[model samples]
Target: MNLSKFDFTRLKNLLPSSLKSLSINPTSDLIREDENNDTEFYSTPRFVHHIDDRARYVLSQFYTYAIQQTPETITLDLCSSWTSHLPENFIGKVFGLGMNELELKENPSLNQGYTVQDLNQNPSLPKFSSNTFDSVICSVSIDYLIHPLKIFNEVGRILKPNGLFITSFSNRCFPTKVIRKWLYMNELQRVEWVANYFLQTDTYFNPMTIKAYSFFDGNFLPITDEHYVDPMYIVSANKK
Candidate 1:
């Protein structure tokens, strides 16, 4: 959908009046089109990139730029899969959490190890210790999270002081799995929605939103693209 033509006023009118005065806190907003067991839905190990090559390159470059200050970084890849999408120069020890063990094991970027857990079913990270990781990254998978606030809290618990929690998403997703709220939002609103998640967490600070691709036009980036390029947005914050 062209963001410029989206009916934001209609969407706002459709929302509960309380939501207008509050953050993204409605439980109904998290409902998915497909409520079937997520484990079963993701049981098949499909090793594929959700975003295109150019978008992937942009994500890798963003990762490199984001994690450059932290040395010997211990990172967590949330909602991870067959690839963590870390830059080639990244030497960080990475742990992955996902629904498919086969895919997680196949991720070369997960140098430390991998765990198979459905975050939608269990938002807790009981296996990880507090302040254990220097960074946590979720790529193109945040839209599918049903219990995002809980997961964000877990990310804060697992991250060290000043640790980075970075999430990036493109104009692509498993439509049936994505939350209903995400479907109603345009690109700019989606960024605000993510930024609000960080704000509500309270444990995170200095939240930053970026248009990782040149095609995006949001509060963070006002550029437009006529070419057929995948648009990507990034929302990142530091653990307080």
Candidate 2:
């Protein structure tokens, strides 16, 4: 099925009005995970793609569209790994920040440069100067954030005015590492959770858009019964 033709209303209706009003203490167990040491957990290099190929293609298409929409000069892939799912002929330089050193070094997508740092330990992007990147992307890794507010603020600081920050996620994740708040909420609420991350930071422009592109329906079954494909959703905002 064509991506544009996919019905998102069913998913949209699941979002609660009180989602934005919801709050949790940053140190609460709701955001904590079974494995606290992210560095240790990510020590072993896992080169595998978290989402399936079709989902990856869908995400890459969205990334391409976002890049074209904003026309980035330089991009940063936060919590990135071996693959960024970027368009093949992307014009701008792409940098990666990840936990595993070997994974960052091996990533073909980070043609420009790459660094290894645990954002949980130091939520601040001290390595990069202020206003350095035109675009920032965090793909499928938002649920793993323990200090999302601080990280989002850092993203806003690093982004130039009017720059875009695109965050995308799917149904799949390492459950043990995913935060309790993320695990408990359904997909639609998870979308709002990301949006709230942007809103509460007060560093990005308002009216952030939440979008969904699913190969499956409300039942979590594939529309075409093609190999199971994970649904993709994005929440995006511009730096003020």
Best by TM-score: 2
The CA lDDT at 17 in model 1 is: 19
List model 2 lDDT by residue over 96-155, tens digit each. 999988888888879788889999888999888888888899999999888888899999
For model 1, residues 117-139, the per-residue Cα lDDT tens digits are 98988999999989999989999
Which segments of model 2 are wrong by more than 4 Å? 3-19, 69-72, 208-219, 222-226
In model 2, what lDDT does residue 163 have? Answer: 77
TM-score list, all predictions: 0.82, 0.86
Error of 1 at 32 (Å): 0.6
Q: Lowest summed-lDDT stretch of 10 residues in model 2?
A: 7-16
**Residue 183 of candidate 2: its Cα lDDT?**
76
Model 1 error, position 217 (Å):
8.4
